[model samples]
Target: GLLRIDHVGIAVADLDEAIDFYERTFGMRCVHRETNDEQQVREAMLAVGPEGGVVQLLAPTGPGSAIAKFLDRSGPGVQQVAYTVRDVTAAAAALRERGLRLLYDEPRRGTGGSLINFVHPKDAGGVLIELVQPAGA
Candidate 1:
């Protein structure tokens, strides 16, 4: 079934500013940063606590990025919740069998070397759910 909470995505207008806020205000540390050109977003991950779960700071990198659109529509805020799974494809299949609405018909590449699928917000009670399986997991 579910493995663990993968990450909590916080949409931001400025990645560096957000990172600094988390670091200085919450004593978190940036652990990873990656730019996804395909998604047109730059993401910086900060470990939250002793458990080391991360808060992903996302900034739109291009004019047409989905994050940019989201910010335009919703402003900077929490975006989506990601959960780790043992097998993303299998998880998607199970959810489909249960008649849950999925954003992706099949698993697709996600950040941090994971296979990911999204459950539609309408089906998930207004919360966008992301199923992620780490590469080689």
Candidate 2:
């Protein structure tokens, strides 16, 4: 079963620039930062408020990264929506059985130590859908 929204990912050309804008506009502070070399993206977590939702600032590290392509084609904007699920592998399998096109055949590591899989945009009404399973199973 799906739990809740994991977090919303925003693609940006410059991570620091985006961080400045968000902080000035929303008064949010950075809670964490890390680079996922496998995904070729650097991310910074910003707290929306106290117990508030988190905002992820993602910047492509190379031209081959998906975020790089997104920025090249559409500029900076909301990139993907991720939902927390109890079991990503099972959830993906079920979705696949229902005829959803998956970006990855299996779940992969995601930010905040979660397992994640992406449902193709073509199968998700043009919006990329991500299923996430939190750390420690």
Candidate 3:
């Protein structure tokens, strides 16, 4: 079952500039940042407010990167909506059972050492849905 919305992912041309804009405009506090080589992205997580919403900003590491492709196609906007799950494997299995296709055959590493998987956009009304199991869970 889904726990809550983990974060909303936004693809950006530059991570540092996006972080600064979020901080200055929305006052979102950046809580984590990392470069995921496998994912080929430089990402940052920002805390939205006192109630704990989060926004993830992602920038491409190279022209062949997924973020770069997304930027070329969509022009740098919302990329994905992530949901917190207790067990990503189980959630993926369940979604599969319902005939929804996943982007990965198995879970992969996500922000903050979390396990993650995605429901393919084609299977979910063109919205990329990410399932995240927190680091320690």
Candidate 4:
């Protein structure tokens, strides 16, 4: 079964600037930050509303990265919506069975130590959707 909204991914030109804006404007403190080399992104995770909700600010590490391409095409903004799931692989299989397009053939390691997969935006009404299974789950 679906658990909850894990996080909302926001692509930013600068991770530091975005973090500062969130901290000053919304009083949100960044709980974690890391550069994911495999994903080619630097991200900061900010908890929100005390309900296990998180805002993930993402900045591209290089020109060829997905975030960088997105920024070039559409500018900085929401990139994806992630939902917590008990098992990401199972969820992805089910989605595939339902004829949904998945970006990855298998789950990949994502920020915050989660196994993640992406649903194609065309199949998700133009909004990128991510399924995440937390570390150790």
Residues 25-97 of candidate 2 have per-residue lDDT tens digits of: 9999988888998889999988898887888889999999999999999899888888889999999999999
Tell me, by lDDT, which candidate is best: 3
Better of 1 and 2 by TM-score: 2
Superposing all C-alpha atoms, what RMSD in Å does each candidate have to the true structure? Answer: 1.3, 1.1, 0.8, 1.0
lDDT by residue for model 4 (22-44), tens = 98999887999999898899999
Ranking by TM-score: 3, 4, 2, 1
Q: Which pairs, if any, clash in model 1?
A: none
Q: What TM-score would candidate 1 get against the native?
A: 0.93
Runs of candidate 4 exceeding 4 Å displacement:
none
Over 100-126, each residue of candidate 3 has an lDDT whose tens digit, in order, gives 998899899999899999999999999
Residue-wise C-alpha lDDT for candidate 1, range 1-137, written one tens digit per residue: 88899998888999999999999999999998999887689999899887889888999998799789889989999888999999998998999889998878777777877788888878888777889999888
> Which of the two candidates, 3 or 4, achieves a greater lDDT against the reference?
3
lDDT against the true structure, each candidate: 0.89, 0.89, 0.95, 0.93
How many residue pairs collide in each prediction? 0, 0, 0, 0
TM-score of each: 0.93, 0.95, 0.97, 0.96
Q: Number of clashes in model 4?
A: 0
